[model samples]
Structures are given as structure tokens and as C-alpha cells.
Target: MPQMMPINWIFSLFMFIMIFIMFNMLNYYISIIKMNNKMNNNNFLLKKNNWKW
Candidate 1:
């Protein structure tokens, strides 16, 4: 029998890649949420300043 540990290698590499993908996705959503909050604040500020117009 020949041994190169192919099964474990594939499983571990796939797991490593998936964890990386998940971390990137989490970072993207956090940025999006922060941007959305800023936009909302700006809108409120505009309305507060332009109440006569």
C-alpha cells in the first residue's frame, strides 16, 4: 500500500479555505453596516439643517 495521506490533506485544505472565506464575509458585512449607519446619520443631519426648505 502506498501512503501519501491524500484524504486528510484534502479535508484540511478545504477547511482552511472555508474559514478564510467566512472571515472575509464577516468583515464585509461589518463595513456595510457601518456605512449604512453613516448614511442614516447624514440624512438626519440634512433634514435637521434644511427644515425651512
Candidate 2:
């Protein structure tokens, strides 16, 4: 039982770190997608205004 304790802790810690890293990667990708969408919307608006003029 004593020897198993350290192995269990190590396994849990490794899993926690992996989940944290994946969450950060997801957030980074979402932010990039949002920025690209904003840029496209602005470009569309500018083109519409030019067409009106």
C-alpha cells in the first residue's frame, strides 16, 4: 500500500497537467478565430460604404 501511494499521486498529477495545457490551447484557438471574424466583418462594412459612395 505504501509503495502504491506515490505512483498514484504521480499519475493524477500528470493527468491534471495535461488537462490544463489542453484548456489553454483551446482558449488560444478560440481567440484567434474571433479576431479573424472581426476583421472580416470590418472589411465587409468598408466595402459596402465604398459601394454607396
Candidate 3:
């Protein structure tokens, strides 16, 4: 039981770190997608304005 306790603790700590990194990566991708959409929208609007001229 004593040896098992250390193993379980280590496993839990590893899982926690993995989840933290996953969440950070997810957030980073989401921000990047949002930025891309903003850029596309701006470009579209600019193109439309130029066509009118």
C-alpha cells in the first residue's frame, strides 16, 4: 500500500500537468483562429471598398 501511494501521486501529478498544457494549447489555437477571422473580415471589407472606387 505504501509503494502504491507514491505511484498514484506521481500519476495524478503527471495527469494534471498534461491537462494544463492541453488547455494552454487549446486557448492559443482559439486566439489564433479569432485573429485570422478578423484579418479576413478586414481584407474583405477593404476589397469591397476598393471595388466601389
Put down candidate 2 lDDT per residue, 1-53, tens digits, no spaces. Answer: 79899999999999999999999999999999999999999999988887543
Candidate 1 residue-wise lDDT, 1-53, digit = tens: 24768887999999999999999999999999999999999999998897554
Model 2 earns a TM-score of: 0.83
Predict model 2's lDDT versus the native.
0.96
Backbone clashes under 3 angstroms, per model:
0, 0, 0
Q: What lDDT does each candidate get?
A: 0.93, 0.96, 0.95
For candidate 3, report its TM-score: 0.79
| Candidate 2 off by > 4 Å | 51-53
Considering every candidate listed, which one attains the maximal TM-score? 2
lDDT of 2 at 13: 100
Error of 1 at 9 (Å): 1.3
Report residue 7 deviation for candidate 3 (angstroms): 0.7
TM per candidate comes to 0.70, 0.83, 0.79
C-alpha RMSD for every candidate: 3.2, 1.9, 2.3
Ranking by TM-score: 2, 3, 1
